[model samples]
Target: MEHEPLPSESHAEVRIVAATPEVARRVAAVLRRCFASTEQRSYPAGREGGTRLHLTLDTARAAEPARSWLATSESTDQDRTHADEV
Candidate 1:
């Protein structure tokens, strides 16, 4: 299927473009997370490896923090029960 990723051997290149180092790192992190077992590379290091290091516009989604217990119905019920018992 087109959705399938190419084999490691088939992947012979890496590219990066970003406004700063932080952006580049975030991009690399996301690529690594999404495409398991793929290497990310960097040009400036002049060293080659399975993992690539480069800059790119990040399109990765950030995980939102979990809501506090007080924000949920479970906590509300607990509070009501405690008030009734008092």
Candidate 2:
């Protein structure tokens, strides 16, 4: 699956699947440099739109320098569980 950037953050999406919480935290750290918060959302697979395992990075306080970094297409590497009525 291809990750798409958050509407809040000038179209930047980085997709990494099945990442452990540790990995998520680290990614969140990197994203924090660019965005304010990164949220994890999971979509069930094999359905319409296929499914999305993604993090939404919000750029509420993205300064000029951050914007500049975003303009460039640079890359890098990489979770959630809901228990009902435990």
Candidate 3:
């Protein structure tokens, strides 16, 4: 079946693959707290019996703290990389 195209906006599709459903759900829960998202869809994945979860997030609606945290984290990572090269 052909699914409808996602709306054209600041959004992201996230896929999480983990050894167990609990782990995938835990990660999804954290994302839900940070952004507005659709209900997650789950599927079986890999020969090792892992779980795959897919959800679409409206990044334009990201929580204030999450946006600041991501910006800070990116700068911190870049600083660490430059330090390592020095």
Give me the runs in candidate 1 sitting further than 4 Å from their true place.
1-9, 37-86
User: Per-residue CA lDDT of candidate 1, range 57-79, in tens?
Assistant: 22222222212321342544445
lDDT string, candidate 2, 1-86, tens digits: 56533374344554543335455556656766766545666555333334435665554456556777667746655223336311
Badly placed stretches (over 4 Å) of model 2 are 1-11, 42-53, 59-61, 71-86
lDDT of 3 by residue, 1-86 (tens): 56667666788888898999999999999999999999999999889999999999987788977878656764434455334221
Q: Give per-model CA RMSD.
A: 18.8, 11.3, 7.8
Best-to-worst ranking by lDDT: 3, 2, 1
TM per candidate: 0.33, 0.39, 0.70
Winner of 2 and 3 under lDDT: 3
Candidate 3 residues lying further than 4 Å off, grouped into runs, are: 1-7, 70-86
Count of clashes in candidate 1: 8
- lDDT to native, each model: 0.42, 0.54, 0.85
Clashes of each: 8, 3, 0
